[model samples]
Every structure is written in C-alpha cells, then in structure tokens.
Target: MHGPHVVVVMGVAGTGKTTVGPLVAEALGVPYAEGDAFHPPRNIAKMTAGHPLDDEDRWPWLDAIGRWAHERAGYGGVVSCSALKRAYRDRLRAAAPGVVFLHLTGDRELIGERMSQRKGHFMPETLLDSQFATLQPLAEDERGVAVDVSGSPHEIAERAVAALRAA
Candidate 1:
C-alpha cells in the first residue's frame, strides 16, 4: 500500500476547517484530527480571551501537530490547522514531508459572519482580523490547493477532495 495521504485543511478562523476536515478525511477513507484539539490549554485560553498567539506560543503547538502527522504517515490521515503562515506550514512539512494542504478561502465579511454565528469555539470573532493579518496564502511551490469556501460544507469538501486528487 502507498504511504498515508496526509492533508491539512487550513485557513483563517471560521473558514470551516472543522466542518470540512472530517468530510475530506471520510471521502478519502482516512482518520481526521481536529487542529484545535492539539492546542494546549494556555493557547486555548489565550484565544478564548481574544488574544492572538505569537510565534513562541505556536512552535510547540505546531510541533505537536507535526508529530501526529509524522506518526500517521504511511497510514493515511487528515488534519485541520490554521497554518496561517508559510513558516508554520514549513514546520509541519519538516516534520512530515509530502503533507498536502487544502487551503479554504473566503471573503472577510462572510467569514466574520460565520464566526459570529458559531458557538462553543475557543477562537472569538474579535481574533478574525488577526488571523487574516497573519495569513499567508499558499506559495507557488507549496504542495497544496486553495478551495474557495463560499459553498455549503459538502460542496467545499467535495471540491477539496477533487483538488487533493489533482494535486
């Protein structure tokens, strides 16, 4: 059998990473790991309180997620991460090479609206601006695809699966 096909469903907050990650994983017959689940308590508390995490706060979290990806390699898995910066993605790649990224994108207003309507998530609507400010779209050489998140979750997941296959 081929190695695990690890895909990171990524984007700014409220782009539907949690909703779409599992769908993509299910479609691909892989396990799904929620990115938020990997965040430490402090990180969650900080975000819950409307504070954006700095690089110092992120490296260890990213490393933990990367470790999960590494362990799941050759077995197939999907994970959701903000992966808002190229450097962050690079860290993940360093830990698990050949990890594909599915970058969900949408308009700020739409995303903000979605954030406002969501419930029980640690990330707040107030941090939406910081997320976008820190976001760096996938570079030309990155192993990923960008899928617009304007459609329903099902549609978005289907599009992401199609893009993943093509990639």
Candidate 2:
C-alpha cells in the first residue's frame, strides 16, 4: 500500500504544469500548490526581467516547495514545478521521499507556440529556449512518468492521473 501520493507536475515553462496540476489534485482530493508561488520576489523579478535562474537562485525556491510537500506528506497533495534538472528533483525527494513527478513534455516548437499564446504571465516565450536547455529528463531510475502535452488540458490531467496510478 502507498503511504500518501505527493504529485509534482513538472516540466519546462510551456508544458502546462500549472494548468493540469489543479485538476490532478481535484481528482485526487488533495491540496494543490503552484510552485511558481514558492518563488521569492527576487526570483520572480529575475525571471520577469528575462534572466534564467542559476542553481543558487533556485535552491531556496525548491526548498520552499519541498517544505510544502513535506508538510502535506501524510495527506498527499499536488504541486506544479519545472523540476527541470535531475539535481532539482533530487532536492525535492530529499524533502519527501515518496513524492512522485508527472513530467509533461513536448517538442520545442509546440511549447513555444503555446507560450506565445499565453497572456499576462511573468515568464516570457524568450525563456522557453533556456528552459528546454535546462531540462534534464527524468532518468530510468527516477520515480516519475512523462506525459506528452499534445492533448487538451483535461485530457492531459486525465493522462497524468492514469500515469500516477500506473506508476
């Protein structure tokens, strides 16, 4: 039996983590946290100014998201994060061992197109290249599944829930 399911919906900027995370949480009857919300003003400012965050800039933000996962471990919850690198995911796992990642993935062109269509978001489409460059896919040993984002948001969420169960 599983202890609790802490799902982190992760991907590069345009993969729809924020869009699908809440639906997954709703389906699972768990609390939802937007990983972007964990970012400090400085980080947000940096990103808004078109600066990609270095590891130093990311540590505290990841720690905060990890803390949230740790706090909600027993009951389970879902959070959206880029978790783009293996090290970043490892940092998160240090906080909640059972945390599972749902990685949304797609081609750069498609993602860039989606990002371009987005409105009022702090992250600019200009950063999509940086995001893709930074993304280190979940390894074979990692406890995660990658779902393609070619479908609608609802469909993507359904696929995520299914993948989580299958995992």
Give one clash count per candidate, in the order shown: 2, 0
Model 2 pairs in collision:
none
Tell me the tens digit of each residue's lDDT in model 2 across 57-139: 99999999999999998899999999999999999999988899999999999999999999999999999999988999999
Off by over 4 Å in 1: 1-3
lDDT by residue for model 1 (12-79), tens:
99999999999999999999999998888999999988899999999999999999999988888999
Error of 1 at 12 (Å): 0.3
TM-score of each: 0.97, 0.97
lDDT of each: 0.93, 0.92
Q: Which stretches in model 2 have alpha-carbon errors above 4 Å?
A: 1-3
